[model samples]
Target: MTQPVHPPKPRPGDRVAVLSPSSGLPGLLPLPFELGLARLREDFGLVPVEYPTTRRMGSSPRERARDIHAAFADPGVTAVIASIGGDDQITVLPHLDRELIRANPKPFFGYSDNTALHCYLWNTGIVSYHGGSVMVELGRPGAMAPLTADSLRAALFTSGPYELRAADRFRVVDRDWADPATFEAEPETDPGDGWLWHGPERVVEGRSWGGNLSVLSWLLMADREISQDLSAYDGGVLLLETDEELPSAEEVFRILRAMGERGLLERFDALLMGRAKTWSFDRPGDHAERARYARDQREAVLRALAVYAPDVMAVFDVDLGHTDPQLIVPYGGLVRVDGPARRITVTY
Candidate 1:
């Protein structure tokens, strides 16, 4: 098939679907969810239309699929954004009607478990986004990060080259969504060590591919959404980042090793690794521990690349994926990584 088609951008004042194609965490965690919806109205000037199962925890895959179908089929709806990402979005894939989604072709914004839908859309020849969930980015405590707000605005309403700048500060430590005070102020953050580059000095531009590393690994194992024709991804830019669960450095290596074994890793001309999320409420580490974790993950990625795609250009600590002040990546859209200039830009 030819390159994926770019969906039309959603204008301000348009109605956007806020559905839970993954977990209905909005129902369980009303604080962030409600705050997120308010921002869509006040800050972004978009009307958020919720679906039947959007807030219902434990909603079935078929039920979630119905919401997706309804969202895309509605002509008044200019875009669809996930309420949040969860573990079982992959199950909803089989229930999706590809023809229906392709026909409507609205921008779908999300990451993490939403990666499942992004891959499915890519296979259907539709360009989808890889970040900016309502609950996470929009509902960020204190206020939305300016970097995230700007990146998302460009992705949602404009079309053209938008250069991505490295975040000067990033937060890996998250506050408890269960607590009321979590919404009172912003989460703690650490100083960002700007991107680290590896490989030959050059520039490479290609369609963007890859997402939450663990989610992609699961998709590979299930044999869903991945192309059997290895050439389909040749010269593509691979975007990868770990989530809150924080998979071990060993696991990251193993996943890339498997992709390399399948000839997938060697196809990409460049790799953009999102800043590693080293701290979580479950395993809240101090400054030193966080630094160590991030460093180890980087080493693991370098180790895999050396064995697999040594010639591929790589940039680490990009502000995308699970990191605070997240940037929206246009899956299947053009991404330019300039190694010599130390710059990165994406075509919305």
Candidate 2:
């Protein structure tokens, strides 16, 4: 197994490249994108430099690859941040120059469809962050979540162990970024109930792997960007979460079952299941319905663990995915899951 490299950290005044590796939603809806860029400048004290195809819709895979290459090759650009995630980043991965990225490793921050890039970094032996997209979490309506800002700040500038905390409150629904009124105040949020731990009493510390489950599944099917020897993941902490698509509990079980059947489920010593995104613009579930959805999904995960990885430590409702106050997780980096003490920590 290749040991991943931690990229050089960026200081407050450094330039961070903001590119849309997937969709160029910034061009379509500029409010959140502009807000995110402003936060990067004023709040974080870092300048954001946009790439050629960053805001251009229908950018080709090769064009996106050129942007990535440009950002990583530039000596002045200290880091790279995805504007948001979309469906076609898988195509962009093949066009990346592995040697160039390896020669100049810098932190890359994103999640969701950006899983494609995360896996690419993992294969190239460079650790990349799996949360904190510019358009979504950082550019959140009103102000950015305190927990998110804290996590991003730590991940961006430091290189050490950071304890993960559950958000006291979280939000799921998206507000219309095109509307001027949406930026007037903070989006609505609900109380967070903390994490649910399962299995025997123990702490498991290892390199972190995995991301959005659906994205992982797609990678598995495409046979791209994964290690040839599955044992590379052995004893690692598997971080998994679902997006707003809201797959059914049974579907979740089936995916886990497939992983188990492939002998992939037993490799992880612990699992960090991000809080499920229960509500979306299309579904618009009520409070009671959302609660039920989360409950059923949790149960599904437990059932899968019982069958495939009975001894593996598992934690549910982690604030790391499609939820507000999202905590950034380091992909292919160190993570400590303490089941007995009910705490989690990641090396940022």
Candidate 2 overall lDDT versus native: 0.91
lDDT of each: 0.93, 0.91
Model 2 lDDT per residue over 1-348, tens place: 757899999999999999999999999989999999999999999999998899999999999999999999999999999999988898898899999999999999999999989999998899999899888888998899999999999999998999999888888677788998999999988888888888887989999888988888888888888777889999999999998899999999998998888788899999999999998888989889999999999999999989999988888999987888899999999999887788899999
Best by lDDT: 1
Question: In model 2, how large is the Cα lDDT of residue 269?
Answer: 94
RMSD value for candidate 1: 0.8
Full-model lDDT, candidate 1: 0.93
Clashing pairs in model 2, backbone N/Cα/C closer than 3 A:
none
Query: For residue 261, what is the lDDT in candidate 1?
Result: 94
**lDDT by residue for model 1 over 1-348, one digit each (tens)?**
696888888888999999999899999999999999999999999999999999999999999999999999999999999999999888999999999998999999999999999999989998988899999999999999999999999999999999998888888767788899999988877678789999988999999889999999999999999999989999999999998898999999999999999999999999999999888878888889888998999999999999999999999999999998899999999999998899999999
TM-scores for all candidates: the values are: 0.99, 0.98
